[model samples]
Target: HLVLILCMFLYINSVLLFTLRSKSVFCETSRYILLYNLLFADTVYLISSSLLYLLAAFRIKLTFYMCSVVILPPVLVYSVSPLTLTVMSLERFVAICYPLRHAVIITIRSTGVAITLVWLSSSLNIIIRVLMLLCSNTEFSFDLQMKDFCSEEALFRVPMYYYFVTAYSGIVFLSAGVTIICSYIGVTLVARSASTNKASARKASQTLLLHLFQLGLILISTFHSNIITAAATIMERSHVLRLHSLSFIFLNILPRCLSTFIYGFRDQTIRPFLIQHLCCQLK
Candidate 1:
């Protein structure tokens, strides 16, 4: 509960520090819009986890519907973060690689549409999964054991559930991975070709690298169950459960926090704001 509360505080702090003001970074660009959306999704994910954690902590009976409500929105919204990152990378690629055509290729209206579609697709994905679960009783089962606030592993049991999660995660990994890698490569090549804009190119590459790194971390967190299971025997059961729960909290919240710091807080606007704030404090 404390951790979740702290996560919320950190996220809100980061957003207020960088994302809220008009002079703030990413505020004007499609990149800002996408970053905000990603942050919002992460916020939702954190809230859901925190809600479940508190409920379980209080011995609240997490019914099938409650579990689904807590589980589904986060699962669905969290996907938007990676998808947004990929799009941000591609947007940067276009800005760097094809500067002249970027205005025409990426516009506010178009990016807005793309974001809407991303949300719609994710919603549809979750809706279909629920419908499928509802239809095929044998393939899907809501396995919630809330003594210790269950993980995604406890959400689905047997048959198509296994296949669905595997395929779903695999597709997200492959697509987002490919999109980031290809976009970064494009940015790198263009940077190499443009001697005058070498600094900007290098900076863009570094930003993409951070995004990739965060994506990798998020993916690892998604497999928190496997990690805990693998190490369960080496540690006490209570220790493992505590660590697993911590991972679930951090994994959902930390990546976005880092992303905000790396991409959002490092903006031109925020630096001056930080400087002024520090000066005021010192005074």
Candidate 2:
């Protein structure tokens, strides 16, 4: 929860800084927009999941108001963000592959439309999941024996809910992976063709490295999801519950922490920006 709060605070601060200094400092409007959206999504996701985990950790009884106000929206937004990212990857692919027509093809209007569709699709899943949870008579309670900060038994008890969650999550995961693979391949081929120019090769290598890092983060998150699904499946069987629970904590929670580190510390541009921001804050 502390980490989540810190992440949320940093993200909000970054947005404010960006908004104030964007015109003077940030040259790439599109890149700034993408980073802003991603940070927003990460903030939402962390907050929502953190709330649930905190509640479970201290055995706090969740009020109806808390569930609706603090929990639902972030979870829904987080789920939707991956789909948005997949769309963004596709957009990037088109921009690089068809630089001649990129401006005409991916205007602000078109990107807005794509974002809307991704949100709508994600919203529908959230609606379905929530409705299913509400209509069902299952009680929501944490399993005492399990070490998971959040309750898997409470969730998987609703098989229908898990089914939809697994399917939609898998779809986003697979789609993102496939699109990244294709995009990487195309970009690499183009880079090879332009290798005659040293500057072009250098730029291409930098871009490729950035994408590789992004793809690595996505893959880590994807693996976390698979671990979760597997854990949820075996949650009822007492024998393997401990092992699954341990895996979940290390796999899911660790990845979220690692994501910011990898993106902020590893990226050439983000690293310097973050360092400068920290220095300013310290001073």
In model 2, which runs have C-alpha deviations exceeding 4 angstroms? 1-21, 24-28, 138-157, 195-250, 253-273, 281-283
The alpha-carbon lDDT assigned to residue 262 of candidate 2 equals 39
TM-score of 1: 0.83
Candidates' TM-scores?
Answer: 0.83, 0.68
lDDT of each: 0.72, 0.57
Residues 69-169 of candidate 2 have per-residue lDDT tens digits of: 55566556755555655665666666666777877887767767776787788788778777776677455532223233334334434668767766877
Q: Give the per-residue Cα lDDT of candidate 1 at 31.
A: 68
What is the C-alpha lDDT profile of model 1 across 90-203, one tens digit per residue?
888888888889889898888999899889978877876776677766544455434445445555443687787778777887798899999899888888773538887888
| Ten contiguous residues minimizing lDDT sum, candidate 1 | 139-148
Using TM-score as the measure, the top candidate is 1
What's the lDDT for residue 137 in model 1?
Answer: 66
Q: Which stretches of candidate 1 lie over 4 Å from their true place?
A: 1-14, 21-28, 57-59, 138-151, 273-283
Q: Which candidate is the best by lDDT?
A: 1
After TM-score superposition, what is the CA distance of residue 195 in candidate 1 from its true location, in Å?
4.6
- Candidate 2, residue 279: CA error in Å? 2.0
